[model samples]
Target: MAALRTKIIACPTVGEELRSLLPDGFVLEMLAYGLHNVPENLHAQLQASIDATGPEFGTILLGYGLCANAILGLNSRRFRLVIPRADDCITLFLGSRREYLRQLSLAPGTFFLTKGWIECGEDPYTEYCALRTRYGHEKAHKITRRYIQNYTRLALIDSGSYESEAYRKYARMVADYFDLTFEEIPGSNELLGKLLSGEWDKGFAVIPPGQVVARDLFYGPEGMP
Candidate 1:
């Protein structure tokens, strides 16, 4: 039998991590990080990408989580779709939904950061800086505080895909700027590795062709199973 042809569609926030483990010949498409700001737009772009994928590929591996229901209705037209069983990219970084929940239990108000997030300027610190440019320091500070008022800690997830010194420095700065505690946590590529290697196990949702993604695939009706 011929080897299966696979492609990867991923959010930019988790692109670097996925790329680090991607096998040769597998095509990877990194969508805009900004799409995350609106789940509807993200859903549309993802569906469009999936729809445009050629029929030659046997499988599409999505490097995404439920993502605020963005994947809720994504359809797999002619190929199987594999998605991580996670709430968001944070679970991808932390390696599993269990670890993500454990960390959340420790600090429900914690904010997570990764190399991709820092490089993309997707964190609150970047927003604060941008706002400061438009509204000056005092006003920007107030607004930024209001935005992240519930966050008590800033965590940098080190997935070991790359060196962390620089990203850690930035995370620390952000935490200090916001008067939040800063901590470095170990991250795992285990989930991404499993996804890339076809270890679909219970950690993933393997959707058949012609099927639309449903919330129950990632979580039960009440929430995470």
Candidate 2:
């Protein structure tokens, strides 16, 4: 009999990107975006998804970064859990933990955007539009301002995972609305490819069956995770 395909549990943003890159056959589960805002709930939902998929696949490939440590304590008794050594989607988008940090150091107050975020309608511009509908323009503007107090730049990352000019335009509009400088950064799928290829080197945390994901496992220096 052929081996069963792996199951993928991913953040919706990155999950969308994975569609084109993942092999022809696999089970995919995409959790909603912005779960980073509610780290605890994100953890619970992911743990639940893992449990649900455990019996179905021998391996579960998590298309997520360290993700605020949300995957930290998840146990896998019936399957292996594999995740990239990244703090969040930004690292996944930017290619590696080093590049993500390089951008942060170069512009600490940047709001990063990706094709996945735009295609999924999870950008701040989407939130702003919804707020405008619910709270009216003035109130929405105020709220948006308060929400973006620390951010000074809006960066759209194209990781060569997907391409869309409309997404680029929308991100530019967001920059104009917020009076933040807009920048375009090239993204890479190097690490993302590694994740799918099961190249579980130090760049990935490969939790064997019957073990749990620990914070420390995701906490090492990006080079030797």
Candidate 3:
């Protein structure tokens, strides 16, 4: 028998850059019904649907009003295309950095992309630390290192951290791989929070408008949202 291809379809968040990133083979559509609050009752239904559907790609959608706390039942693979409205900084970088970078680069943009401080402002290295905490620092850093190798250029702004000197030193290693620039500023978290939450109201988060604002939206030092 031939190897099975992954099934890829689930709840969608309406509008977001990631929608554009969906592969040609995958199907994109809204959930069977609107999720008022991550629908606790739907966990079994979702799991059953995913299991019965036997999706090779197994993606689940996250709609507006669905809080992360609502559905703590989901594992990493509950949906291949899991779209959590509010995810931990570290969780975003769970995959290999090189692979993630390649995936990100292949997505549909070339201009400068920015993730607001709401996601990275927690502790400056909140995402990095989250990754390390969840997957270990060495592993997370290794992944970052690998991804850095593939990119020919990188420009970083360390405005999120109060410890500018430390960020500057770390920027050197990243700079060794790609051209890097570090800016020291405080309150990146606050800046990002406002931007994504529509306080600034002129950002990517507003594209697929109508969803809970994140305290912090995690991605990378100089990466996509």
Top TM-score prediction, candidate number: 1
lDDT per residue, candidate 1, 1-225, as tens digits?
667689999988788888878899899999999898899999999999998998679999999988888999899769899998888989989988889999999999999999999999988989988999999999998999999999999999998889999999999999998999999999999889999999888888888999988888766653453
Output candidate 2 Cα RMSD.
2.0
Consecutive 10-residue window with the lowest summed lDDT within model 1:
216-225
1 versus 3: better TM-score goes to: 1
- Estimate the lDDT of model 3: 0.36
> Residue 40 deviation, candidate 1, in Å?
0.9
> Sorted by TM-score, highest first, which candidate order results?
1, 2, 3
Instruction: Give the per-residue Cα lDDT of candidate 1 at 25.
Output: 84
lDDT of 2 at 114: 84
Itemize residue pairs with steric clashes in candidate 2.
Answer: 66-86
lDDT (CA) for every model shown? 0.90, 0.82, 0.36
The list of candidate 1 runs beyond 4 A from truth reads: 221-225
What digit string (tens of lDDT, one per residue) describes model 2 on residues 7-87? 889987888778878887788899887677888999998888888774547899888776777878888778888888778
